[model samples]
Target: MFIEERTADDLALIRLLDAAFAELVARYGLEGRSGVGPGAHYLVAVVDDETVGCVAVQTTDVAGTGEVKRMYVAPAARGQGIARALLKEIESRATDLGYDRLRLVTGHLQPAAIALYESAGYRRTEPYGTYADRPGTFCYAKSLAG
Candidate 1:
């Protein structure tokens, strides 16, 4: 498997993101809406040429911080550590971009996701941004060394 950066107009990735986010809403009753426009940078995980997972890294006002947005791994690829790989890749990019902190907001109902972040050294934090307006939004943050 490999990861590649995707352009904003990549329709295939946009469809994948739509499906992934729809699942999030169906599973946790999430609103799944974002005011952040469509230019967010995306990374696609390909396994044998098939898009198995994807993640987006976006900028924020918080100095040295990178936001994890729209992370999703296809169901068949879930147990294979693809999500973790994608996250690690994103983190690496964040660090290279001079971000010292990485943060993400996920629904509490997604236990597996929470576990993934926790095992990756992320810690639970108070609600941030739009998540603060909704209940059960579990936010996690990890401060980088460099």
Candidate 2:
């Protein structure tokens, strides 16, 4: 599979993302929500010309930092390292955008996601955003070379 930047309007990407987010909410009791905003930056993974995974990142209000808003790999596409590639791609883009750090919040129930982020050089961080103080949220951050 190959990864590339894509619009949130892509029908396949949207459906995959929706299902992924719904799963997160159900599994982790998460409350974070998503929207099409100015800060949005999205990427999708394609295999055989079909979108199978996706990720979204946005510059947060905090200077020098960016947030990974969403990441999803279709069930059929899991275990293929798509998530790792997407995370690395986001960090590359964030670094190019002059961001010095990247932050993301996943849910406690998603061990695969947490492991993906941690294995990608991200470190656990204090809670932030809508999930702060929520028992099921796990936050992470990675410093980029500005």
Candidate 3:
């Protein structure tokens, strides 16, 4: 599979994001929300020219930090490392964009996602931003500095 940077509005990436939102809503019984915004960076994973996974990063209020958003891999594409690759690519792009750290929030219902982030070296962090008071939200952060 090949992964490359893409725009937040890319059609295929939008479809993936929609699917991810739907899954989150079903899993968490909450309304879907969009995380893409101005200046966000996106990366898509493609296999046989078909986009199967995507991730994005956007600047956070915290200086030198970025927030990871819209990380998803199609259900059929799981187990192939697509999500992991997309995440790694986005982290690299965020670091290149001058972010010294990255943070993300995922619901506790998503054990697989939590495992992925933890296995990737992210550690639990105090909730921040809109998630600060939201229960069941699992916040994590990882420093990009070497």
Candidate 4:
């Protein structure tokens, strides 16, 4: 699989975002989708020229920090390491953009996602921003600094 940076408005990215949102709604009901805003950079994983996964990073209120957003790998693309590739690419992009740390929030219902984050070196961290008081939210952060 190959990963490349894409604009937030890219059609392929939009489709992946829609799918991710649908999955989130299915798993957690009608909760708000937060942390996606202006100045975000997105990346997509392509397999056989098909966009099969996507992830994004946006500047956070904290200096030198970015928040991971809309990370998703199509169901058919799961188990192929697309999510992990998208994540590693996004984290690299975040660091290149001057972010010293990356943070993300995933619902407790997503055990596979939780495992992915933990296995990727992300440590459980206190919920921040809008997610702080939202129960069932699992927050994680990984330092990009060596």
Cα RMSD, each candidate: 1.6, 1.8, 1.1, 1.0
Off by over 4 Å in 1: 35-39
Candidate 2 CA-lDDT value? 0.81
Q: Candidate 4 residues 1-146, lDDT tens each?
A: 79998998799989999888888888888894544899788889999999999988998889999999998999998998889888988988998999999999998899999999999999999988788899999899999999
Residue lDDT tens for model 2, 1-55: 8888878677988888788878766774445454535758888889998888888
Q: Highest TM-score: which candidate?
A: 4
Local accuracy of candidate 1 as per-residue lDDT tens digits, 1-146 = 99989975688687778888788778765475553345567889999888889898888878888899888898888899899999999998888888899998878778898999999999988887777888878899999874
> What are the lDDT scores of the predictions, listed in order?
0.84, 0.81, 0.89, 0.90
lDDT, candidate 3, 1-146, per-residue tens: 99988887689988998999899888876644645779888889999989999888998889999999999999999998888888888889998999999999988888999999999999999988778888888899999999
> What is candidate 1's local distance difference test score?
0.84
- What TM-score, over all chains together, does every model reach? 0.92, 0.90, 0.95, 0.96
- Model 4 misplaced regions, further than 4 Å: none
- Top candidate (lDDT): 4
lDDT for predicted candidate 3 compared with the true structure: 0.89
Query: Of 2 and 3, which scores higher on lDDT?
Result: 3
Clashes of each: 0, 0, 0, 0
Residue 78 CA error for candidate 3 (Å)?
A: 0.3
Sequence-dependent TM-score of model 2? 0.90
- lDDT for 45 (candidate 2): 86
> Where does candidate 1 have its weakest 10-residue lDDT segment?
30-39
